[model samples]
Target: MVSYITSTQTLSFARKPHPKEEVCGDDGAAWDDPDHTWLVISDGLGHGAGAAKATEAALSWITANYSNNLEATVRGCDKAIRHTRGVSLNIARINRSTKATDYVSVGANLGWKVQRSGIQRFAGDSGVVGSGVRNLKTTRVDLDGAGYLVLASDGLNTTSDVSALYHSTFDGDVSLAEACLERWTTGKDDSSIFVYRFT
Candidate 1:
């Protein structure tokens, strides 16, 4: 697990490998610039080292050539890891001042925004990152007030009610992530969860 704190937001990430595997297939990263904070999650196709390799390649490309443009960044990641097993990818760019976020996702990854009122789900375009992308589009949402942004790989049960989990066990960013992983992980594949809290 890793955590990042800023003046406006706090982010926490946690991941676990499949029970039979030594390496996790899902990976993620978060970084900040003067004007924006970036978050990314990548889940490779299968389990074990090959899947880990694909995720590592995608994250490395993003680290070396970080960009604020969500679509272009996803395309670049697709190109960078074309040789390895393809991955499911999601990227988010949040404005430091306005709290508006631009998010893009490809493949089966999941995302949601949880506020006091309700939970808003974010869906990704249908395609694999390294293989190809179709109907690529960026979704925008406002994170100005208190809320939580949750991103998870398919290893976590998508059918689970995250809003209920948030409301019941909401302590802080780190605890929310830990609870989600503890309660929802499928245990058959690599699992990852990212929770971002903004006020």
Candidate 2:
């Protein structure tokens, strides 16, 4: 089996139910299949209960149908959450055999491949998954050795400033993702980051 590891960091708006809020603004899921490893991050449309509901709805759909191809999984999520507030989501699948990657995004979430060479951004199309999806497009890239794909919800500050990550030694450590998530977090809204390493 191919070696794959994931690290995640999540924070709630104002620290959540400490103030009696029912849910955070975002949620996510991850798993490994025979041919690919999957990582998904979802941000609901707004803050508080509605946002949490939307994200959870989308996440449930993702969990139930992620075994499908990237495009179909996204469409399933879109259909599943149409009655809710909708969500912004990013899904990434790493091919266990070829070390290649297939990913799809909807709404404002950000994702990218971090390699020794440089960062390869996965720009998502406009429109929410459960709302006004005009089209769904999958971005494919080869995730060669020592490559990492990072997916972040919009709650983070700047998705482009991933330079610090490349500076770290490529020892296949989860600390890199932890450090990046800690350093980049704005602490404004519900924030989360998922790191997938192909080793």
Candidate 1 off by > 4 Å: 1-9, 170-174
Whole-model lDDT for model 2 versus the true structure? 0.71
Q: Write the per-residue lDDT of candidate 1 for residues 1-199, one digit (tens) a residue.
A: 2225344446778899999998898998887889888778889899899999999888888877877777888888888889988999888888978989998989888888988888888988989888877679999989867888888998988886877754585545556677788788988889998888887
Estimate the TM-score of every prediction.
0.91, 0.81
Best by lDDT: 1
Residue-level lDDT tens digits of model 2 in 17-107: 1123456767667766777667788888877888888888887777766665777788777888999999998888777789778888988
lDDT to native, each model:
0.83, 0.71
Best by the TM-score measure: 1
For model 2, the stretches where C-alpha displacement exceeds 4 angstroms are 1-22, 168-175
